[model samples]
Target: MNRKIIITGTTCTGKTTLGKKLAKEFLIKQIDLDDIHFLSNWIEKENTAFVKDVNSEIEKHLEWIVTGSYQTLLKDTVWQEGTLIVWLDYPLNLILRRYFIRTYRRVFLKERCCGENYETLKSTFSSESLFLWIFKTYWHRKRRMHHWKNTLFSHKEWLILKHPKEEQKLRNLLYDN
Candidate 1:
């Protein structure tokens, strides 16, 4: 398809899932920022290094579905170059519900994260929990994406997917190739 796609949104919005599906269907590479951003024990790669590596990796591929919300880290470079920017604007309640279920499974089932970090029951219920983080950032992220789409990425192509119930609609929009 010769597409350079960026699938982004707040947590549990299916950005990574859609990216993987598209990449597999198209036989193109898929890049998840989480994979490049974190290390063992959930430690972060240095900001400079992470940005460099991500940009370098993106530059090497002609077709890819890049998923993540690290827009500031990328300096708008990827957004400016993307063929399509998919923003999954799901409801907060839905996101929270999904996050809770995912985290619960991770804690009890020993599901490993992108960095090979496992969630602990203690951590899952803590103030530092990803659930809390997502709760706090959901609205902010939606606002920011809106602003960027109109401002920083005004000229780029965009696909704003909202509400998961619109399954056939989403498929139709995405399969427009």
Candidate 2:
């Protein structure tokens, strides 16, 4: 398809899963920004360096699916070049539930996430916890995406999948092509 796709949303919105599935189906490269933005030691990459590296990597591929909410890092490059922007606008409660489950698995089961970061009770309960982060940013993210949908990215091809049925329809449509 040679499509440059971006799947973005707040934490725990299934961006990575959808990106992986689409990339696999289309035989294109897939990148999760978190994987390249955070180091193994959990230190974040410098903003300039992160932007440069991500831009370089994406520029190397003609077709790619990049999943993450890094508008600051990618706006001029990947985001601008995207053929389709998939915004997952799930409900706040659903996002909270998903985040809780994901964090629980990571913290209790010691599951590794992007950047090789693992969740711990101490960390999960701390201000840095994904759960707390989601609570703080979910509404803000939704508002931002809504703004983009109406103004900034209005002319671009976009999909706002708010429910499982819509997501399934999107999947079917993509797979059909």
Candidate 3:
């Protein structure tokens, strides 16, 4: 079967970057879960609608690499259909630094995702902030992956990439294999 990859990790762990890369390498479409979940002004879509849309996308795409860490609504669908789950487990310091830098860049440049733009420093530091979310969920995500790595899903192929070198190695392996 052709692989359907799900790239998931804590916020700012380069899932999007690596997903895009893998998609390009394999010539598959890349789906950003953020694009489906966020609406104008950074508001989250309703859970029911969000799940429906995600399910629709998963069904519509023949082969894809979807990237996100939104487990509350979309995890079950992704885990069920994804042939390989690539977990980007980077250090907290690295994630924190990337979170701040990416947030600053997006805010300063007025870059928008899912029709939302960063409008204020307070918005960037609040409970809703990706930075804080990453810090809050880092260990919990790690633990969940640890548990997941031993389940039926564990028997499926999983690549836990921790560093740039390992990521490159996995990329090479994916292409070679």
Rank the models by lDDT, top first: 2, 1, 3
Candidate 3 CA-lDDT value: 0.80
User: In candidate 2, what are the lDDT values of residues 1-51, reduced to their tens digit?
Assistant: 567888999899889878887778778899999999998867899999999
My TM-score estimates for the predictions, one after another, are 0.92, 0.92, 0.91
lDDT of 1 by residue, 1-177 (tens): 568888888988877777787778767799999989999888899999998888899889888789988987774577767888888898888888888888877888888877578889888779988888897888898888999889888788887878766535545765786
For candidate 3, write residues 14-74 as lDDT tens digits: 8888888888888888888888888877788898998888888878878888889776466
lDDT of 1: 0.82
RMSD per prediction, one decimal? 1.7, 1.6, 1.7
